[model samples]
Target: MPEIKTLAGNLTFTECPRWRGGRWWFSDFYTHAIYSMKFDGSDLQKEVDVPSKPSGLGWLPDGRLIFVSMKDRKVMVRATDGTVSVHADVSAYVAGNPNDMVVGSDGVAYLGNFGFDLEGGEPFSTTNLLRIAPDGTVTVAAEGLHFPNGSVITPDGTLLVDETLGNRVSAFDITPTGLGPRRDWAVFGQPPKTMHDDVFAPDGCGLDAEGALWIADARRGRVCRVKEGGEILETIEPGTGVFACMLGGEDGRDLIMCCAPDFIEHKRIAAKEAELRVVRVTVPHSGLP
Candidate 1:
């Protein structure tokens, strides 16, 4: 077993972890803030606050910070001068609040959404992943995804998306116009019909140097190191509800796990019980955040 340790606590649901500019950066959902810290958990800093609640985070080529504003169904951009602006409004194409996002090196972003009223206990439904160009033009990159959550683009230009309710990681070829044909990168089991069903619910994830993915198994309260074709190479039970995992650090072997008691909106907002945890791994991180 790999030794796990607490990096920081007193958070209310952390997500969208990325290792960039020599720090571990993440968003605390209920707190509505994004934070960053050093390898040993020192120098913790609250980078910014998003009143609509922030989720996934990435950087544009020009150094602007772009992130998901979940409740407002928009993508926000923070410039070097700390000015925040709406990068894109995707409410017209989405059925529910937008969630995770991964911006490619070329400055194009692929975004995901819940597909239903998750906290309100609505039934599950498929959704689309929207592609936002550098000019902020929004288009449906792909459709029929069951709760497309965390996403990453492989070095070879393949986009891998975690379908939380679909029990699989879907892949698509990155093309000039948009995405190409869809394929299954990894399948856990049959897609769960309801939220209460036995499910893995892959949330935020990170890619490793060997091309495998470290996926946060949301409903299972664990993190899984999975290979292509649905093979589980390893598992790490963080002893809490692990919502997101990212491989990053000085050498990119630090697996940062976001832990919380639960994901209920009200419950998380009521207390600061969430934590950021970490464990060391062999492979360095690879691909887009």
Candidate 2:
């Protein structure tokens, strides 16, 4: 219920905001760059450059940073010493570009795909979810998904993924090898028709301590908190395109939203200028990465 404040300016399509090592890291999909900043928007640094576009971010138990390379359809990792390398190649598993990802406690990274083109083109509808192991091996975890975007693993090792095109969120039991059969976790009834970019539809998300899902509703310009039974608990409206968000601030109660300019009339245009913003809320839950 608070107005969102701009944290940084001049971002070219920011997505996948994650909090790690006392810093907030994110990617500019258009610029193909990864950046990090302090909670107060200080000491901004360019972490690395990626091939094509980069989205979703995760960290290994060994302190390595992992992110999805969209156009390349691969998972890349950056070491603490600033070395970058390909962690997994999943071109054969994903139908389109890899979009967002979440690292599990078992050290495996669960990734989802954009499932289609965004520039007013047709989607590959064959989009699927993949799991990348610590040894750089890739395997299909789920298939026939309608553009799997933001995803997170529960504290008990349950994998929950947001199906943007299908307007629902699904859950799967996590195993050492891969994911189990999925069940319905939540669904967004009657998503706004103004939504176009399937990749940014129900974009980024976070998990609360009680296992509730907080989704950044890009097209609706709001953040919705949903229960495990697909019930809407609350909705926080942050004007503009709420591309992504993360829970970070002094008390770990603030929600930082990565928002783009309104595009109601120009949904097909690929203009940037999305501002990185933050808003404080009464909820005091620290988020899971």
Candidate 3:
């Protein structure tokens, strides 16, 4: 394990860390801005602002950037010239705010939603994973997911979605018919038996060279490396809130983590306390997530 180091700080809840274009890109929920900087943390640049706050980040095969506008439930696109526009309005399919998304090699995106007002302390419910094709058509890719949070697409064309409230990572085969029926790829903790919930939780994750998952469990104040069958291989202490993560760096061994004290909506929307930390591991990353 490599020593964990702080790469950036003074953010109000950073999520959706990504390694792209030779830099680290992430979003600050409270600051309403997306930022990018060198791996050493220099040349920090504000890439964009999302009045509704941003969550997930990805890019199309054409090199256009896509980001989630959490509050407005919209998927936004940023062009090469820095022009931001609405790619699609998802309010009809996902009543709750959308979260993470994994853009496939073909440019199709599979995204998840909260399914409830998490910050307002509302009751939980099962949600759908919205599938948006390159042409901008939106449809339900999969459903009955309990707070589908982070997700990954393996080289073999399989989709693995982390059910944060369900205590398990579910798998689906992407086929012409659509995403196959859900199956368990890994299981951990004793998740609530019901479908409506949040915080039963494994918030964000990354896939390794050997098919293992590096997960950040916000509720548990820790991060864990586990095999597909749910065997815990390693763990990282959470000095603060570890809400999201990404695997990046030259060797793809850098474990980029999104940390904050907590994710209380009201609190995060008002202060600056989030950070980005990096921990290097033996295995490098292996897929689109």
Report lDDT (CA) for all predictions.
Answer: 0.92, 0.76, 0.85
Ordered by TM-score, highest first, the candidates read 1, 3, 2
Clashing pairs in 1: none
**What are the clash counts of all predictions, listed in order?**
0, 0, 2
Model 1 C-alpha lDDT per residue in residues 92-156, reported as the tens digit of each score: 99998898899999999999999898878788888899999998999999999999999999999
User: What value of lDDT does candidate 3 attain over all alpha carbons?
Assistant: 0.85
lDDT of 1: 0.92
Residue 59 lDDT in candidate 1: 91
Candidate no. 3 TM-score: 0.95
TM-score of each: 0.98, 0.89, 0.95
The reply for model 2, stretches above 4 Å from the true place, is 123-126, 190-201, 262-272
Comparison by TM-score, 2 against 3, better one: 3
How far in Å is the alpha carbon of 255 misplaced in model 3?
Answer: 0.5
Alpha carbon lDDT at 270, candidate 1:
94
* CA lDDT, candidate 2, residue 218: 67
Runs of candidate 3 with Cα error greater than 4 angstroms are: 189-200
Instruction: Give the per-residue lDDT of model 2 (tens digit) for 1-289.
Output: 6676788877677888887777888988767799999888889998989867888888887878888888877788887788888888888886567888988766788888766665457644546788888888887888877678888777777888887776778899988678899888886564423234343356688877666777887677888777877788888876677867767666767778878765332431356577788887666554357
Cα error of candidate 3 at position 135, Å: 1.4
